[model samples]
Structures are given as C-alpha cells and as structure tokens.
Target: MGLCLLISCGESGKRTSVDPGTDTQDISSEESKPVNTPGKKTIVFFGNSLTAGMGLEPEESFPARVQEKIDSLDMDYKVVNAGISGETTAGGESRISWLMRDRVDIFVLELGANDGLRGIPLSETRENLQAIIDTVKNHYPDVKIVLAGMQIPPNMGPEYTAEFREIFPDLARANQAYLIPFLLEDVAGIPELNQADGIHPTVEGQRKVAQNVWEILKPIL
Candidate 1:
C-alpha cells in the first residue's frame, strides 16, 4: 500500500494497514454492542489517516467536527471515527468487519488514495474497494453508505490517474451510495491548509473538511 501520509505535495510512500481490531488509537469511541441507542443512529467513518486526523488532535479531526454539527442540529446520530493511519483499501477490507462490531447506519468510505499512489492495478483497487463495500452490506443490509472520493498526484500516469479518479463515482453509482466527489476538493495541495508534512489537514483545513462532508452528509442524514 502506497500511503502518502507524510507529505501530500512530495514523493509517495507505502505502508502496511493498521488492523482496526487491535489498533484503538484511531477509533473515536468504543461500543461493545451493535450500536448506540434505540432511537439514535450510528455513522461509522471508515478511512485512512485523513479520516484519523493524522497531524492533529482527535478534537480537531473532521469526525469530531461532525459530532459538533450533529449536536447543534439536534440530530440523532453518533459518529464513530473508525479511521486508521496509513491504511489502504485492502487494509480497510481487512478491518471493516471489526469496525462493524457495532451497527453502522451510515458508512462513509474514504479510501483508494494509497492504491493510486502505489500505482496498484486499477482493477485490483476497484475490486478491493468493492469487497469492502460488499462486506459492509453483508453485515448491515440497510446501511446507507457515503463514498468520499479521493484523488492522487499524477505521478502515476495521466491515463491511470484519470481512471483512478473515476473509480469513486463508478463505485457510488454501482453500489447506489451517496457520492462526495473529491474529498480533498479545495484542501489538497494548499500549503496554508496543510500541516508541515503537507499531507494531513491542519485544524483549519479539517474545519473546511467538516464543511465539505457536512454539505453532502447532512442531506443524507
């Protein structure tokens, strides 16, 4: 897995996926049962370091921001940050079942960047991502999914890059999931918005990231 967690603007690097079953740091909260409450719903955000708030505090993370929004709107959803630092699609595939230890009313899938960065076979990336989706559906048949699309640098090749970018929308349509095209829309590559590593979002960037997610997510909620 070529996970570019260090610098979004520099050379790409790979890393093994963190096992969600064992790695507890990325999880925002823990629940032993199949969900939170009888009336309230649960939204499990499944992604890589980007979702984990790699370079920032858990409070400054987008997931925490989402929690604040939900609180203000008086919504009844508890967001669970099931993000893992340095995770790839395949890693997500392996860890999804564990995260699903609790029910997922909404599953936000933000992955595939590492695959594109690693220049893995597009078909493999697509298949692995599909597998992750399939796993979620297998456990929670009625769970609504929000696929947060990601993009990678063009270092791989224009054709490969284009096809990779197209993967998210394709998956969304095929899976009938909500699409938030380009999760890094206005935040990627912007120096002031990123941490020193240039990959992870700073606190300000995460706030904007929260807005980006909320725009697409609120309607779904």
Candidate 2:
C-alpha cells in the first residue's frame, strides 16, 4: 500500500493520502442528500479515512457500494457512512455517543488505523475502541456490530505492528462482534487497485472492498 494506503489508514499523522480529507463520507458531502429510501433499518459504518473512501467519489466508497448491494437484494436497509478522515480510536470514542442518534440496526466499527500509524500506545487505543463499543451497545442494546481490522507498514516495527494488528480480533472476541479480518484485504498494497496516493483504493479496488465487507455484513443482515 505505498504512501496512500499507509496514509489512508493513518499516514503517520499525515494527511498525504488526500489533502484535507473529507469530514464525513455519506452518499454525498452534502448532508442533505438522501441516498437511501425512507423508513429503513440503518447500518452505520463508523471509521477513519479508509472508511471515508478518501479520494473516491461517495458512490464508489465501500459503504455506498454496500448500500447498492443491499438495494439489489430489495432490502430496506440504509447504509450510513459516518467515516471521518484522519480519525483515530480516541476521536471515534469521543464522537460515538453523538453519532448514534439514529436507530442503528448494525454498527460497523472501522477505527484505530491512525492510532497505529501515529504509534500511539496499544493499550490506550484498545481502551478507546472498547469505549466506543460500550457507547454503541449502550445506545442500541441489540445492535449487531462488525469490526473492521486494519494494518500498518513494517516501518512501525514488527512487534508493534503485530500488536496493532491483533487489536481488532481481540476486541471482536471480547465483545462478540463480527470481525472482518482486514478491511483492505485484497486491495491494500496492490498498486493498480489503489489511487495514485498508494493509500486510498481506486474505484475497482473499492468494488472488491465492498465485496469483502458485504460477505460479513450480508450474513448479519
């Protein structure tokens, strides 16, 4: 995943992947726009820039793609992309309460990559993530959760990177959350699949990413 995927996840505290990354990634930066039909159960994807689809168009992002997949099944499920570029577990923890305003039937957690890139303490990052989970559970007691795991380059050191990589599975096991082994999966580190930045996935790559997520999300739905 060159600088783009590296930065897309966290980018060593840099916004090089997509300068001035977008704040929230829904169907449109235009909050007023409605991507899903009304009166549907909502599935909220909450995470960082990778979840935000950094450089890709709203419809090309995985969350949006998931929406398309859901619609194709004729399901009345709405996908809400609450992705904030450059967001870390701490950032997500602080904001989880507010974002749960909707009645989320499914809450997909995609945070912590930035914390890994920034080399934040694993314990602290874990705690913040757990806090976010706790908040989500508090809000929606019956909500199904999907945790998206992320990875960083070896430059962060093998021991640290290994520990960082284990965070998601550990959280999933502890919370009984459905785990997506890796968010980027077949997309990360693939030159052609990623945008020029080497971080964010290209449209083709996003299609694969969406499929990766849908496999896990579909079963839950």
Worst 10 residues of 1 by lDDT: 7-16
Q: In candidate 2, what are the lDDT values of residues 1-221, reduced to their tens digit?
A: 33333544434322223233333222233331224447788888887677677776777778989989999999989888777677777767766766766687888999887777778899999999999999989988999999998888877888998999899999999999999998888888789998877777888988998999998999888
Candidate 1 off by > 4 Å:
1-35
For model 2, give the 10-residue run with minimal summed lDDT: 25-34
What tens digits encode model 1's per-residue C-alpha lDDT throughout 1-221? 23233323222323223443344334334521235767889988887777877766777889889989999999999888776665677777766777777778999988888677777799989998999999999999999989998777778878998898899999999999999987877888788888777788889988998999999999988
Colliding residue pairs in candidate 2: 1-189, 4-197, 4-198, 4-199, 5-198, 5-199, 7-11
The parts of candidate 2 lying over 4 Å away from their true place are 1-5, 9-38
Question: How big is the positional error of residue 132 in model 1, measured in Å on the Cα after superposition?
Answer: 1.0
